[model samples]
Target: MAVSVYRGFHLQSAPNSTEVWQVKIKNHVLTGNLAAIKKSIDWWCETASLIDPREFESLNAKREESTGALHEDFNGYTLKNDTGAPNAWYCFFNGRLIKGSKLAIQKHIEAYLVAKQRAEAKQAQQKK
Candidate 1:
């Protein structure tokens, strides 16, 4: 099975500080096994919660908002706008909007893909 990974994050803007936290997954990693991915994502979100409780609350409140919560789709995870279009500036994942350059996201994505592929292969060999 092929794994797909996507990157996502949350952005917080305040008078004094602008903070961003993001995560990237390899292609099909999340989509191929939604349950496992969701659990991993939820765990990450919990970790983020320790950093800023308010951010977690904000995510919970806006859970219904397409861009505010984790989105799982064929194209990959993304932060949707009010119109339900993927936001170019940031992709929301694990309860955050990741703010970074395309290159940065791509690098993370590649690393995740390689790691996931190796892990899946190992699991398959173990099953045999």
Candidate 2:
């Protein structure tokens, strides 16, 4: 079976009774058994989301040391975009992972800008 996420990543299982998933994120391919993959994804969705930014940095550093690659950190989540610009970003944290396309990142960035504008507007009004 093949599953698609973020329009840039796909998960496919090898034909036969194998429980391994071949997850393709742009040009990167990750092959993990079902149990490990599920555990990783579950951790990302459940545990990593609750981690503090400070603690996450420490944890991410360890991940880079072990994995030997730079993973961009965002609010405790590790984002990996090896497929170049305008592609999807694979987010991994707390032993879990997910994929998000450029559009997804843009949406988050836009939201941040809106929040900043709101905060600035409030500050200006208070100073007036």
Candidate 3:
């Protein structure tokens, strides 16, 4: 299960027109493992947070108006693309499409969980 994190911005060429943007983060495939994938997602989200909030806010506002609803803050995970005909999962951030297969997304999430566990373990050690 290879997994990776992708980041990009969404831009609309015109009102009610199609939006497009380039992914900033490079695509990566990790070993087949759910944990690895999850970790990737977590890491990606954290990294995205470092971006200027204004940029994200701008994108979110546009996306909300285009989609007709406000969305959760850019937590680095969202359904980017999905067709009812075929089962698929995609994650997005700030209206940018973060392309990845279901398996890849799952792995990214797992990676996050793993990182969390490690942090907890470290904290526990310090407490002693």
Could you tell me how far off, in angstroms, the CA of residue 64 lies in candidate 1 after the best superposition?
A: 28
Per-model clash counts, in order, read 16, 1, 13
Cα displacement (angstroms), candidate 2, residue 73, comes to 16
Local lDDT at 112 for model 3: 72
TM-score of each: 0.30, 0.29, 0.30
Candidate closest to the true structure, highest lDDT: 2
lDDT of 2 by residue, 47-115 (tens): 643222234445556656655333566654457776444455776433566567745754665576678
State the displacement of the C-alpha of residue 118, model 3, in Å, after optimal TM-score superposition: 1.1
lDDT of 3 by residue, 1-128 (tens): 12224333222122332332222334432221223233344456777433332345465566555553222222355444333212255565335555555556657666776788999999999999
Please provide the root mean square deviation of candidate 3 (C-alpha atoms, Å).
21.4
Q: In terms of TM-score, how similar is model 1 to the real structure?
A: 0.30
What is the C-alpha lDDT profile of model 1 across 6-89, one tens digit per residue?
235322233333232223443212221233334446655666422223445455456546554333332365533343333443
Error of 1 at 92 (Å): 2.1
